[model samples]
Target: MFLLMSSNSHHWNLMAVASSSASPQEKYDVFLSFRGADTRNTFTSHLYAALCQKKINAFIDDEELKRGEQISPSLLNAIEQSKISLIIFSEGYASSRWCLEELEKILECKNSYGQIVIPVFYGVYPSDVRNQTGTFGKVFDELEKDRQEMLQRWRTALREAANLSGFDSDVIK
Candidate 1:
């Protein structure tokens, strides 16, 4: 009877352990969000290479998703688990709806999860990002044509995000 009780207790403990165990997080050191056509082969590539050289685990999307397709759940999980997000605000960045959505996610993560957001103003001004000037303004104008409410949200997000500390590529050049 004592041996049977011990075996039952062991099984119960194993069941408890299995039930309580959580899956491992897909943590990343950095997540890079950029307009691939604008800078992927140049600045984005260089930045990714540099981060890799520094032994940082970085995620950058290299493939094109079909229209209406969602970003991979694994990649989204990685983004959520990343310590830092690097946003490359190039000329055509605001033109891409997918990039805008990714930017929104990064900003949301920063606000809710204490993640660090670093904006790289590549050939764009901080004021532009903050105030939606120039290309940023033009993109917002286009967005406002069909989705005024959503554009407002994006504007607020862009303004708040631009306030975060970052590097200006023009200054580096």
Candidate 2:
């Protein structure tokens, strides 16, 4: 049975269980976040390969979770335990409310647990993330019109995330 834990406390998931046989050095060093439909086979794949080549353990989602499905407690615990979070901000990322919530949680870890957040501006400008321009701006505008409080929370998260050190896709290649 999948256990759903409160957002206020740490949720544990059986799927995320670490092996007792594995040493501490075998643990993943980074948790990668990206919109799979946007750049899964290209940029994200390459980045993951490179990190693996360098011996950096990285975790990335292979399947998209449906909206309204509970995010597994194991996944949340994995994100919290990772030493670094590499967020690949594609154009459509902010449009998904789920991704936005994941981003918010990552930011929470950043502030409270000192997890490092490294944003990768994939096909979008860093300014766009900072200011919520283009598609991102449109999404936020609509959310603000319909849900003021939620929009405020999202805006605060976006602002904090934008301040993190990042690289554009062009620079990466």
Q: Candidate 2: which stretches are off by over 4 Å?
A: 1-26, 140-145, 171-173
Per residue, candidate 1 scores C-alpha lDDT tens digits across 53-144 of 65667888888666577667766776787777888998777767777778888988888877778888888998998988898778666654
Tell me which residue pairs clash in candidate 2: none
Least accurate 10 contiguous residues by lDDT in model 1 = 1-10
TM-score of 2: 0.77
Following a full C-alpha superposition, what root-mean-square deviation does model 1 have from the true structure? 15.2
Q: Which stretches of candidate 1 lie over 4 Å from their true place?
A: 1-26, 66-72
TM-score of each: 0.79, 0.77
* Whole-model Cα lDDT of every candidate shown, in order: 0.73, 0.71
Steric clash pairs (candidate 1): none
